[model samples]
Target: MASVARQARSAPAPALLSIGQVLAKLSPEFPDLTPSKLRFLEERKLVAPARTASGYRKFSSADMERLRFVLTMQRDHYLPLKVIRGYLEEMDAGRTPELPGGAVAAASMLSAERKLTRDELIREAGASPMLLGDAISSSLIVASDVFGEDSLAVLKSLVELQRSGIEPRHLRGFRAAAERELGLIESALMPVARRKDASSRARAAEMAREIAGQLEIVRSSLIRSALSRLDS
Candidate 1:
């Protein structure tokens, strides 16, 4: 079997992938990918496609697959680009990078996992119906038939907050604050999000989520640091 890189080099080069063609191939899996976002990924050195004699970019099947892997890791694992790049570099060096156990299996599991019914979510978080209602009313958890990992994380926080009498209503401002932060991210990604390609749009969304997750981590760390000062 031809190596993925070799196959990419041997594939017939298109005249150029009109931003449209790129989206058609990549969008089903990555619905939010856009042309500018693709360029942004290039700028970050996550992907390097071949340039035409006239400077037009021409991606290969291999490039597409590589991109799929990279985007999937960022979206599902919350991995930063630097860490993802390191993993790719290991693969490029002819070593099979050891993914976390059942990583591939886990990818398939996400949709089902995200389909947690209301009762299931309450059970998982050990939360009561009243608490769940408060969470939804406060916008800390969006009302949905099925809940994703994001909802679960919020539920976990609510469980902790319950102990301190910080009910869901008390954290309603958190939802508003998150929206404000998201607005900043959307503004930064405006140029990229304007493109019509699905892959680029998907990649942009994944990038936004990754950045938001990082911000949440930083915010948590700062709060913990401040609390330690009080303890001292």
Candidate 2:
């Protein structure tokens, strides 16, 4: 143990990473993270990376951890930047504050995102290969050898719906509905998209997120209203 400690002490520290390197390390899990988004997060004071003598940003390991936490909170819980910033501030002040809405904690954020093989996804989601195949056939899921978290989530939901006698074939209309919504978003974005400038591109992405959030609110309200009628 002492020899191990001595070796550890002799080891070199990790190098500070550039923005591109940070993105390369993180983008697989947070595919939507772009340079502009990182800058936006920095502007919001979610993270404070170091600036080089030449004005380039350099991120330490702690910065990476904070970024992962912020991104995970946004992706999984859909928490807004203000809420997340408040929660983080509490933590920074040496208070172990609970996350609002029971969001996942910091420790879990450090783990790498899972990418499962077809068989692994089936096993993990408790879904049958045939069900997955049917889902692909129905355009509910793309055919892929390796599946990401979104695919796993969909498969898990399908498994529960399957138990209730709902099949992938029955949800085929969902794909079409999604395409229509995409069309609407694209049409709304045409003015910004036509600008062909970096800032406009970033604004377009932010606008797309805002529009999608509003649409989700409308969709969820409709579903809840329909369910209330069914219950009545």
Q: Write the per-residue lDDT of candidate 1 for residues 114-189, one digit (tens) a residue.
A: 5689998999998998999999999888898899766876897899889988988888788889888989889878
Q: Local distance difference test, per candidate?
A: 0.76, 0.85
TM agreement with the true structure for every prediction: 0.59, 0.73
In angstroms, the error of model 1 at 207 is: 6.4
- Go through the candidates in order and give the clash count of each: 9, 0
Which residue ranges in model 2 land beyond 4 Å of their true spot?
1-35, 50-60, 73-110
Show where candidate 1 strays beyond 4 Å: 1-29, 33-69, 77-80, 90-113, 190-214
Best by TM-score: 2
The deviation in Å at residue 198 for candidate 2 is 2.9
Model 2: lDDT equals 0.85
Among all windows of ten consecutive residues in candidate 1, which has the lowest summed lDDT? 100-109
